[model samples]
Target: MKLGPIDWAIMATYFVFVLGIGFALRRYMKTTTDFFQSGRSIPAWVAGLAFISANLGAQEVMGMAASGAKYGIMTSHFYWIGAIPAMVFLAVFMMPFYYGSRARSVPEYLKLRFDEKTRGLNAITFALMTVLSSGISMYAMGLLLNLLLGWSFDVSIWLCALIVLLYITMGGLTSAIYNEVLQFFMIVFGFLPLVLLGLHDVGGWAGLKTGLEHVAVSNGFAAGAWSQSWAHMGSPTDNPMGVEWFGMAMGLGFVLSFGYWCTDFLTIQRAMASESMSAARRAPLIAAFPKMMFPFLVILPGMLAIVLHQRLGAGGFSLPTKADGTLNYDMTVPLMLSHYFPQGMLGVGITALIASFMAGMAGNVTAFNTVFTYDIYQAYIRKGAPDAHYLWVGRVATVAGISASVAAAYLATHFNNIMDMLQLVFAFVNAPLFATFLLGMFWKRTTGHAAFIGLISGTVGAAIHHGLTLPLGSVPGIKGGWLGLTHQYTSEMAQNFWTAIWAWSTCFVVTILVSLVTKARAEAELKGLVYSLTERLKSDAEAWWRRPAVLGVIVLALTLVLNIVFL
Candidate 1:
């Protein structure tokens, strides 16, 4: 894993451009809109790429790779089944209300569509979620850098934090979006070569499949289990993922996917930055293009790492272990980079990871600052502050958010799989959120009080469900069952899926029941917010192919083909 001077030079060169972009955009930061919302002037394509790149952080790169190592091709479910349809639904159905309502953040939308309490609840929780998610990006970078460079973990995380802070604080959302686009390119170029080389070493797709059979069989799964996506999903015991198709479809695919893609403000903020409603709608639909290709760049590396380690024996690397003596799957991607990459290319690979780390953390910080400035601080702390004063608060919030994330980074260290921890958070937060948004936007009769009550009930239900269920072999603690184990799941991921399902169902049911007893808002007040009340959106695109629906259909078809091919 030793690096040469050539590798150092490549990394050094990348930092210059990253900082230069921020410094270049600093002159435009005279107003809050310019700083926090990118002046709503970014083109659809730029916003689109940034949409995907904003998510290209620790969870996507390291976490997906980790899941790939543990679950094999079943990990692609995160993209094919879990992400694609949801992105399509967002662009085609949800973005109209989001863009049309002129809401500043997701919480602001809830306020416009529901009530103050629901908005307040979402804003505070979203602020915390962004900080924690940002911390994940920080923790992964810190840990990976420590492993690769033998640097102190504390110093590495802090240094990365300082770099992101300067750029994001300087140019704000505009800087974060532009840098995310750059990170997207760097990630593709840097990681595509690794995938190519790894595939070559393992005899391409056929050889990789052959190699995975032994690993799958040794782990108590059916032969060829690692090579197929849905084939082994009929029974939890048939595959490494250890969840039935029903849970996979209803939980990860329906609840978690729609919850994140539709409701989470991180990716939604990128689209909201676009110049026009047309562009905003097009953003996520277009982002799905690159999102579809990421399994190879990230997931395949993990799959290859595992097989290659076994094939190459002791000279090759093994995954790191947790304090409890189980494999720490989060190390899968970095270990693969160290094993397969040569000196010059190794720098590119490392820089790609750095780019992802920055895009992810910066996206979170920028979103956090905006939500704090508008949704929380403006609404609660100071109602009539001047834009100048609020702008000042945003900059201050950026500093505070990063500081909190640095603390939260330590919290992530307690988990064996970083993805497991992130999913648990999403299950508690986003899963129930989709229900609130669903009823609020579609059923004008849904009252604000009902929405607020439903949100609390959903979050509480998630906590209860999580506490009552234990992932097999995990003791009652962070992984759940502290309240007493009523049900046990085969894997942590399986537990996450079912927990999300329970949370979503609870929220959906409670919202409807409460709405029946509560009085609805005036129909006039629901105008631009509710689906039945609002007029349908017309595409501004001149060509048929440019329409969001057209693009969404094309991508979904391609994704379907991939799923079937892999199956």
Candidate 2:
């Protein structure tokens, strides 16, 4: 596992190039807008790439692969169903409110649509989640470096924190977005070869599937688990994912997907940074093209890992294991890299790993700084501050955000798996967010009080469901339910989907009930914010094919084809 001089050179070159980009973009930070939103001057393609890159962090790259290893092709549901539809919805339907309203952040839109309390709740929750997610990436980076390169965990964390802080502080969101694009390329370059090589070693896709089928047969599981997506989804006990089709669609596709893609400030901020309304509207759609194909790169590696492990045996190509002999699925990608990549390419693979960590960390810190500065500091602490003063606050907040992430990284060390911990957080924070946004945008009757209370109730409901239903000894950091309903869940994944379902249901019902009793805002005040009041701004100047609706239809159709093919 020792890296050669050429590998070191490649890694060093990547760091220099990224830092150089940051310094080169330093001239753009002339205003708070530029610092926070890239002066709204980014092109549609660049914004689109950054939109996906910002999310292509450790959690995604590694987690998706991990899920592929654990749950087979069913993991593609996270992409085809859970992401593409929501991303399309964001681009075609939601972007007008987000972009046309001229709101700087998602929470800002809430403030305009609902009230200050709703905005406050969203801003604070989003800020905390961003930092914690950054911390998780940081922690995963350190853990990978420790496992792969024998680097000290603490040293790895601090080194990554310092690197992210340096580039992001120098150029702000503009720098982060640019680096994310670069990271996206690096990830493709790094992992594409590994997948090709691994596929070759596993004797191509057909051989890999056959190998997994044999493994499943030997292990006393369904033979089609590795190849089929929906066949085993009829019951939780039939597959490793343990999620029924209804729960997968309603919980993951409708609730979690929309919540993250449409509402989460992390990805939305990238679209918001686009130079024009057309670019903003097109960003997610453009990102969706690449996203539809990402399972091939990310998830395939995990499937290959399983084939390699089964073929080579434990002594030949080792899989990461916990003390209890269970697979540490988060290490799937790293294990593949260690097994397949050679010297020069090894550096590329490791650099991609580092790039994912840095990009993810930068994404979170940049979003955190922007939200905290504008939504919290400007709105609450000191309104009408000089633009320069706010810019300074943003930079300071960037530092604070990264610092908090470092602390959170330390906290994450206690968790057994990075992907599980991330999913747990998503269940807690993101699952219920879409319901509030869905009501506020389309329904003018959704009062601020209702939005705020429903959000709180939904979040609390998610926690309660976890406590009541999650089984003991199921996964790390989760014990049996306080209500002694531990036997209710067929698997932890099932528990997660059900948790989201309950959370979303609670929010949806509660918001409706409260909004019924509360007075709706005046129509004049709802202009450009609510769906009914806003004009349908058309992109008529563009060709018919380029229209968001047209692109959305194409994407949806393609996604349907993918689902059927995999099913």
lDDT of 2 by residue, 335-364 (tens): 788788889999999999998988999999
lDDT of each: 0.88, 0.87
485 Cα displacement, candidate 2 (Å): 1.9
Clash totals for all candidate models: 0, 1
- The residue pairs that clash in candidate 2, if any, are 40-275
What are the per-residue Cα lDDT tens digits for candidate 1 across 1-567? Answer: 787999999998988888899999999998899999999999999999999999878567888888888889899999999999999999989999999997988999999998888999899888988898788778877877887788789998888889888998899999999999989999998888888888888889988898899889888889778889999988888888889999999999999899999998999999999999889989998899888888888899889877876676633657777999877888787777777788998999888988898888999999999999999999998999788898899999999999999988887787547646664665587769999999998888999988988887887899899999998889998899989989999888788888888888899999999999989899998899999999987775458888888898899999999998999
The TM-scores of all predictions, comma-separated, are: 0.95, 0.96
The TM-score measured for candidate 1 stands at 0.95
Q: Model 2: runs farther than 4 Å from truth?
A: 313-316, 414-426, 472-480
- Per-residue lDDT value at 25 in model 2: 83
Clashing pairs in 1: none
Error of 1 at 376 (Å): 1.0
lDDT of 1: 0.88
